[model samples]
Target: MKTLKEQFDILSDGAVDLLPQEDFIRKLERSIATGTPLRAKLGLDPSRPDIHIGHAVVLNKLRQFQDLGHTVVLIIGDFTAMIGDPTGKSKTRPALTLDETRENGKTYVEQAAKILDMSRTEVVYNSQWLDSMSFREVITLSAKYTVAQLLERDDFTKRYRSGEPISVHEFLYPLSQAYDSVAVRSDVELGGTDQKFNLLVGREIMKAYGQEPQCILTMPILEGTDGVEKMSKSLDNYIALTDSAKDMFGKTMSIPDSLIARYYRYACFAGGEDVARMESELAAGTLHPRTAKVQVSGSLVDRYHGEGAGKEALDEFERVFVKKDIPDVIEETVLDGTSLDIVTILTTTSMAQSKSEARRLIQQGGVSIDGTKITDPAALIDLQAPVILRVGKLRFLRISGR
Candidate 1:
């Protein structure tokens, strides 16, 4: 068993907040001395079926707990998914049907397996306990927290002040989530910084339920490929867990040079000492940013997909980006050649995720057609022959139409 201090040092890396840090240390000490693993809870609502590298930041922290011989209770919030978490939403979230919730929940676990150890992980559905609760039981649970306390949530307060119609059922979302901790008897709860409000509620609710309050740990939000907004599937800036090795490598390489070190800390699992050295080299200008990015991109792909995939991806990236050579295997999407806007063409070729993004790249001179930079996004071209399309420094496509 690692000493409490040693475990704390490892667990604290990349974490944004660990509420009442002393409690976490004490829990670690108890777990170590008793040789009893702590139960770490992480709840997920299945509203979003796909998970991205950004989601991995918290999963990685959970894995760290598992490495220390702790039990990870992965609670699929099938019951809660119906209500949808109202956190950070200016308006009410659309409710999910039970069938849609179940289907999404199924994919959630499958994708989470890429990061979580399914064998050791205790996969559970909150529906098991939450579904069985009587109305009286729910009311009793609701009675524990006052409306004034519920209003403490920033998003709730913001929406209320803004006069956005806050739904009454939304209040149940946090209460139900807190009930999950009580059901599982969680010793530690982990989540993204966005989840701090919900996690802290778990602690208070646990204490109210006559259980030891779970220590809360929250990780920083990982920035997406844009290197601007938080990584999100909705933002189309996410690198999905199910992405192909080639796609993963390519997307990771697209991140701005400034985000390479941040990705190292949040996205990649490179050893701490090694990450330190790379950051140092980049900081001192000893290592070229491009070279460091290739390493980061390849390492990330290899970690998720396979060992050698990274090197293969690196070689392919060099051939395409550095040598300005077209890849042997370009995804060929055929379309009718009657007429096509260049912006639409860019999206169809997967060069850009949206028309707006395509236009941005075109206006910035980052897009070219037939080896000529296409400054006008509205340029309509007939794809009679195979046309070469290049976006930014990386993506290349061969578009063909009848």
Candidate 2:
């Protein structure tokens, strides 16, 4: 049988770069040998309801640990969510109400279970402990780290340098996250590369608490569908786990061809051999980027929604996008003899945002009318029949004529 660490390496496809792999492996071997499964912690502030594929990257890694007979402690930062984590934010996030946090937390578990094993995992809310602590106790905990040390964080440092408002509460966010490790006595913790500084603080706190320092594993950030920035819902660049099969497949297909290999390695469970084969095919010119993208999208949709839906979505993509065929479903808006211009129809149906913008897009070959590209600013519409309006690659709107 392979060692636990070896199993993890295989499952993660060697994408994770542990700070000290050998030390962690030795510790893991000893923990397993002694029949004591290591405690692993992953924290998520439920500030947002939508969980994207980027979040799944970490959850999938946690699942691997759980499968290896280790304890997986999921920390829901209900308290922190209210304060708003200052991880990647330039400006401090606006505070969320307690009721809002509670309501969002309830639905988050359902989405989280799509990636994490809720039955085997130990689900915890940080508010349970943080809320009960006294002010002096909080101060005592706060003293563990210095202002200088806290300011070292990139976001804080940048804000301080650039004269941006760095809220005082922001300093306490990582301190609270660090205290979570101490509270759970976590043996190992996982986060994205952007979270390395926060994860490292957990080790310091764990040591201060007289427990063995937790091993930190940071995974690479999954690029958003834009194929650039980290996957984020606010950026409108995410493929939500809850997104329908058709939407998921379409969004995945929309990603730039350059992102396919990276997505395969991190987002999906494609192994070394599978990835190598795909890369070889791309290198040898046997596979086109679109075909490869379709495969990638199909596999992802199948993983989330099921095989049948994946195939349907794939077919839908081919018909609607590749072949420029009409979609199965199109919105029908009744025209009630009220005079409506083409620009108004386009903007109202969300085919375009404004008349000026619509005209610009049309001139750029980015707008189409009934599957035909339209470039005239003064294009008139007779609302006596149904016509489809398309914008760029993904948006479609149907306007019915009176």
Candidate 3:
């Protein structure tokens, strides 16, 4: 077992806040003294089917706890997901069906296994307990927290003050999530900084249930490739765990140089010393940003796509991007006609979803044929020979006449 200081240092590496640090230290001390592993809890609401590297920030911390001889309780919030977590939301999110949440939860667990040791990790669905609670029992649980206390949440407060409709059931999300910690008897709970209110409520609710309050650790939200907004699929800035190795590497390379160190620490889960060295070297002009980015991107690809995949991705990336050459394995689309409009070719090849989008891509000079930008949406191309149709920076398709 690692010493308390070692455990603390490892677990708190990229954490934003370790509330009641003394309590956390005490818990670690007690666990080490007694030779008992601490149960660290992380509740994931499978509101989305895809997991991104941004979500990996907290998971990486959980993995550190696991590596240090601790138990990790992974709670899949199938029940609370139906209510939708309102953190950082300006409007009420539409509720998902139980089936949808369950399906998404399965995907969540599968992807989470990329980081967590699934066999050792205790995976539980909140619905196992929350779904069994009676109306009277729910009322008892609801009585533990006041509506005013719930209103104190930033999202709730904003909605309340703004005269926006706040659903009564939305208040149950935190209480339900809090009950998860009590059910698992977690020693510590982890969440994003936006979830600080919900995590703290877990401590209060656990105490109310006559159990030791779990310490809360909050992780910083990882910014997307744009480096301005939080990483999210809705913003089209997130790199999904399921993204292809090539896409993942390419996307990681596209991030601003400013985010290189942050992505190394949070996304790649690089050690503090290594990340600091890279940062210092970059600042001193001893290291090229592209070289550092390739390392970071390659590490991510290797992690999710298995060994040697990063190297393969790097080779392919260099061939396509650095050498100004198309991928060796581009998907070919055969058309019956000799000539086709740029918009039709784009949409027909599934490169663009709609004609308007194809036109937009053409107007924005994001569409190219054989290294020539196609600015006119109405331009016709003769498909006499196979031509590489490039869209944006990553997508490529070969068009040829049948």
Candidate 4:
């Protein structure tokens, strides 16, 4: 129902800052005229099993193309994960073993499918093509880009100045990623702003192969829970897409109030006048940020899980966290008769990371037993009765008697 440029703008949300707009428009016009949807490709290095909302920002662009009757090819960088992406790393990321890579890739596809329609999407592993390149071919591919250009990338520049060891194989990473575009003959490639350097490399490589360069669309990076750094698993600041609805809602609520609008506009499907109104409402002090965040949380949870689950999650949050009432369907965990420290119980049940962390949490007035704050880390937890264990302001665990 939208024009080519209009659809492009809609997908980009006016955040696209790629150069050479004319070339991008020309390619898009050609695709529109030919009634061929652009071949949009996004590559992911599945070094981690979980995908976050940050990754979904690009995936949402791909979905727009799909809805507009285009082809989206998702490249699972199984081959590249072995070497790891050095895009913004100060030090090299340790390579994942073949087995680990495979396992992560499987989980990546399942989680990514929450945003992308796998039925309409073509999933590819770069290893199929990258592994086939001969030594001569590899050299030929690497010859297109100079080492100086490689060092120009932000991470490489920082690492070079800091005297961090930049491995030779890391240099090949961008080239291998660029080759994916050439292999797929992609009409467009989508990535976060940090990946613009590598995505542009794809454009150059495509041109060298006597093919029209794919148009690059770079999106603004979504900040993690910390609101100051990029969302990443390594930083322990990401909210995994696979998190339960309650967990997702709670994490979303924990984000700084300032980040709510951006998350709504970019991460969620909120757009156009709706987004404008939300922003205005915030500025006018009409809508409370907490309520707005709850809406954002529900929208995101509905996107990954379902509307029913999202509503249920909200209900659970109100019942347990707001009204201070115990959940009806408490999980019953039958434990063996053992003398366990309360902190140990919290850690063992994943309420906290370790006994020390649990103790800190309790000392901060963040831990509760049966709706009462218990600051004693050395407190004994008897398995003779069921008790509700609360951690911080959100998580709850139901512990039952042996």
Candidate 5:
């Protein structure tokens, strides 16, 4: 069993805030002495079923707690999903049906299993308890917090000041989320920085219910591959957990050099000392950003995939991008000997979104056929033999004429 200090050191790494830090240390100490695992709660909004490295920031922290022999309470927000979490939203969020909510939650646990220990972890659906509450019980739960307090939350305040509509149910969203801590008896709740308000509310709600207030730990929001916005699927700036090993490595490499330290720590790398050392080396002009990015990318790929897959991805990346060599898994598409528009072929091969985009790519010197650069979007080429179709970087297709 890990000592309290050892556990704290690991848990605090990359965390943005550990509210009531003293209380967390005390709980950790008690757990170590009594061999009773602290219940670390993390509520998942099933509305977003897919998780990226950004989401992994919190999941990685949970993994640390699991490593320290702590209990993980993965609260699937099926009940709250119907209500929709109003965190960081500018406008009212559209609610999902119970069926939609439940459907999304199914794969959520499976994806989470990639990071959490399923056998030791306890998965619970909020609907199980939230649905059984009487109106009076809910009213009593509501009595715990005030409207003024809820309005003080960042999103509500911004929405109100901007003259946007604030649904009454949106106010209850935090209360419902808070109630999860009460139901699960969470000793510590982990979330991204944006979720601080809700996490703090859970602490207060737990006190109101005559339980020990759960400590809140918020992790930093990971920047996307673009290095500008938060990693999000809506923005297409996310690397999905299910991405191919090569794609994942390639995406990690695409992140700005400035984010190398963050990606190394928050994405998957476990050693805080090592991440710090790497950052120090970069700052001291001892380590190049490109080389550091390769390490970060390799670690991320190796974590999700395997050592072999990680090596393959690293080699493929170096070969395709550095050595100007082709990848191993170029798709072989058999097509009849037919004349095809360059734009049409590019779009058909999923290299670009539309003909206009394909044309733009061609004009930008990003489209090639059989290693030959084709700058003319309107050019039609007759496919007579197998030829490799390349688009920008990281996309390839071998078109064969039959």
Candidate 6:
């Protein structure tokens, strides 16, 4: 078993904030002395179907706890997701149906398995207890926290001052998420910085219930490829865990040079010491940004894909992108007509969602045929000969006449 200091160092390496650090240290000390593992809880509301590298920031931290021989209690917020967390939202979010939340939760667990040891991890649905609670029981639980206190949350406070609609059920989100920690008797809770309000409420609710309050750890939010906004699928700036090895590598390479260290620290498998050393070398110009980015991108691809997938992805990337050579394996599409307009060709092959989008791509010089830019959407393609279609930077399609 690792000592308290060793465990603390490893667990707190990439964390943004460890509330009541002394308390966490004491908890770690007690757990180590008692030969008992701590229950580290992480509540995930499957608000979206996809899990991206942004979400991996916290999961990776949870994995560190698992590595330290602690029990990881992964709480699927099936019940609370319906209420929708109001954190960082200017307005109340649309509530999802129970069916939607459950289906999304399944995908969440499956993707999380890539990081967590699923066999040893204890996965529970919050609906188990939240659903069973009577109205009176809920009322009694609600009385534990006051409305004034709930309004103290930044989003709630801003919405209240700005005259935005704040639904009554929205208040239940944090309260219900707090009850998750109570339900599982968690010793530690992991969340992103935005979730600090919710995690702290878990600590308070546990105390009110006469249980030992769980210590909360917040991980920093990862920046997307744009390096401006937080990684999000809605913004189309995210790297999904489900992306193919080549797409993952290509996307990673697109990030600005400034984000290389940040990505290495939070997203990659590099330890704290290694990350620091890399940062130093980068500052001293001993390590080139492109070289560092290549390594970081490859590491991420290897982690998501299998063992040798990174090398394969890197080789393909160099062949197609660096050398300006067409990929050896391009998706093929056969058309019924011998000739078609560029707009029709784009939409027919599912490259563009709509004709307007195809026209826009053409106007922006993003669409090319046989390595020649197609500026006019009305341009006709003579598909009698196989034409290589390139869209934007990475997408490619081989079109041929039937």
Error of 4 at 278 (Å): 1.5
lDDT of 3 by residue, 110-145 (tens): 999999998779999999999999999999999999
Error of 3 at 125 (Å): 1.8
Per-residue lDDT tens digits of candidate 4, residues 1-402?
A: 568778768766745665557777786787788887778899999898899999988888788889888899999999989998898778988878867887899998998889888888999999899989999999999999999988889889888998999999999999999999999988888899988998989989999888989888888899998898999887877888888887888788889988998888778867767878888998999999988998888888888888677788889889877897776676656556555778778877877877777888888999887878887888887667777877777667778655
Return the TM-score for candidate 6, rounded to 2 decimals. Answer: 0.92
Backbone collision count in every prediction? 0, 4, 0, 0, 0, 0
Global CA lDDT of candidate 2, please? 0.82
Query: With candidate 2 superimposed using the best TM-score fit, by how many Å does residue 289's alpha carbon deviate from the native?
Result: 1.1
Give the per-residue lDDT of model 1 (tens digit) for 268-343. Answer: 9667788889989999999999888888988899889989999988888778777877777876677877579998
Model 4 CA lDDT for position 9: 80
Pairs clashing in candidate 6? none
1 or 3: which has the higher lDDT?
Answer: 3
Badly placed stretches (over 4 Å) of model 4 are: 353-365, 372-378
Report lDDT (CA) for all predictions.
0.88, 0.82, 0.92, 0.84, 0.88, 0.92
TM-score of each: 0.85, 0.84, 0.91, 0.92, 0.88, 0.92
How displaced is residue 117 in candidate 4, in Å?
1.7
Candidate 1 regions off by >4 Å? 331-402
Q: Which stretches of candidate 2 lie over 4 Å from their true place?
A: 1-5, 329-402
> Please, what are the lDDT tens digits per residue for candidate 5 over residues 37-67?
9999999888877878787889878988998
Error of 2 at 317 (Å): 0.5
lDDT value for model 4? 0.84
